[model samples]
Target: MKSNRVALAALLGLIALPLVVREPYFQHLMIMVLLWVTIGTGWNLLAGYTGQVSFGAAAFFGVGAYTAGLLSFHLGVSAWWGLALGGVVAVLVGFPFGWIAFPLRGAYFALGSLALGEVMRQLATIWESFTQGMMGVLIMPTFLSKLPYYYIALALAAGSVLVVRLVLGSRLGYYFISIREDQDAAMSIGINTTKYKMISLSLHAFLTGTAGALYMNYMGFIDPHVVFSLHDISIMAILVGIVGGVGTVYGPAVGAFIMVALQEVFRSAGFGALEALSKAIGGGFMAGLTKYVSQAHVLAFGILVVVVIMVLPNGLVGDWRKVSRLFKRAS
Candidate 1:
């Protein structure tokens, strides 16, 4: 346990990077990465560990962002309080989603969550009175400097990691693992699967919602489109989960770093060069992947995701640990 604590502290120190990275653009990217990392970790706790497979994370995320934005714009409330309010609302709403769907297992649960997310998205779009419709509410810029945003994002991401670690180390985590492996078997053994599952969902929603509120404060804008983007819902969180080795404690963080790093690298490599490289390597593979993607970049991301999933089903971190253990055994 002492060794584990030391290792965790060392890993966190490494994450406290970019404090010295002076470029504003890099800082912006770092902040965005951390924001997603935080949200992804929250999502992982429910879907990965608890085996809930939620697609409604975007709903909570959008709710939190809009909640904070609305309060700050109309009522002159501080963001700190707004963040908590958003989290509470998300947890309350999320409870029903889990309660209704918890009886169903596997894909049915996933479909229900996806349906809920879409409903929330549509509500945000139509509810102009509160959400401001397509025009969206803008957060008047206060301190334009990226430093504060960077630190805030970092803190949130760290908080998420710590929360997940705590959960994984506790008795509840063992129950979640049992439930994930076999719900019927776990329930047969006398675990209250329903109560624990709801708890996981509620906590997940709360944390994701809090991160969403932080996002609004950082970006200074909130629109239904930006807040509840389907691409953001289906792709971003899932991709992080897949890349990080879904159920593993350290997987999401590793996945976030790799995903953000790849984006940064591709963006820096010049779009034309990236496209040319993609075409040269896999002709139609990259082209088909990029088409209709809102971001409009080449489909390198999809190909990357596919390769990672196939080559490392347990995810990058999990697979890397296996290799390290194997090497140590051989030595």
Candidate 2:
């Protein structure tokens, strides 16, 4: 009941956010956070709950984007069609791969997944006539305002959390956890380990693909390098899950908000406050200071990665009590 109240309060706050913060920049950031929430949730289901750490999330993500992009390019239909088709296409693409890859197990599976994004990227790049190669595909956006996009992204984020919650509440969730705890034991107990793992993978691919479709529609462009990126897309998904707390239902949402916010802050150099400071100084010191700060943002993020690894293994949501106690102790 306490959680329900807190959740309701949080939902209401989000619903009222756009009304209070009319700045498009802030709204865009919120939208990006929600997008990452969907992505992170998908990764959490497969890697966190199922104990299958995959590095190929970008493979499905890219399929979803291309699904939407191709529909517009060849069919001449509205890219909005991707909202329905992208996830389906992603599932279809992943189904065959899961058949082959699901049997690997452990670190070997992870290593196999590492090639997924690269393979997709190479295909998208080499097949220029179909994917337009590195030239990429662009779609004309349907809306001039960000409001509709924001609500759609909110729906996606909420839907992902809700779906994972439902699954975890069901017998399927038990099967998943059992497999995660001990795959051989689960198999010994008559649980279909491979079947359940595939189910988890499917759910993850579908959610990720749907989010990718959303990205294509919202950004109105798609390219292999951006969509199937290893560092940006795949690694960011892992960081979101880790930062939020792996295996927790709402962890990805919490992590998405923090990771997205931090990225924006560092990328913009404290949202350009440093630029103002540079202007205030107005001399040789300004350019040097700005350049170093801009370059140092990566270092700042690296430090955060280290902190999360060493201190926040349970994540913000899962480790809430520990964090609160530290504050209480300090007070």
Each prediction's number of clashing residue pairs? 0, 0
Each candidate: what lDDT? 0.80, 0.89
Residue 68 displacement (Å), model 1: 0.5
Tens digit per residue, CA lDDT, model 2, 197-311 = 8899899899999999989999999899999998778888988899899999889999999989888877787889988888888887876777777667557767877898788
- Window of ten residues with lowest summed lDDT in model 2: 293-302
Worst 10 residues of 1 by lDDT: 289-298
Q: What is the TM-score of each candidate against the true structure?
A: 0.86, 0.96
Give the Å shift of residue 161 in candidate 1. Answer: 1.2
TM-score of model 1 (CA atoms): 0.86
Candidate 1 scores a C-alpha RMSD against the true structure in Å of 4.4
Best by TM-score: 2
Model 1 clash count equals 0
- Tens-digit lDDT string for candidate 1 (1-331): 8636864785566466666677887788778788778878888888889888887788888888888899988898876566778888889878888889999999999889888778888888898887788888887755688887777778778788888889888988999888999999999999999999998888888888888888888788888878787666546777788898788777788788877777666655543465666678887866654443424333667887888878788887669867678789999
Clashing pairs in 2: none
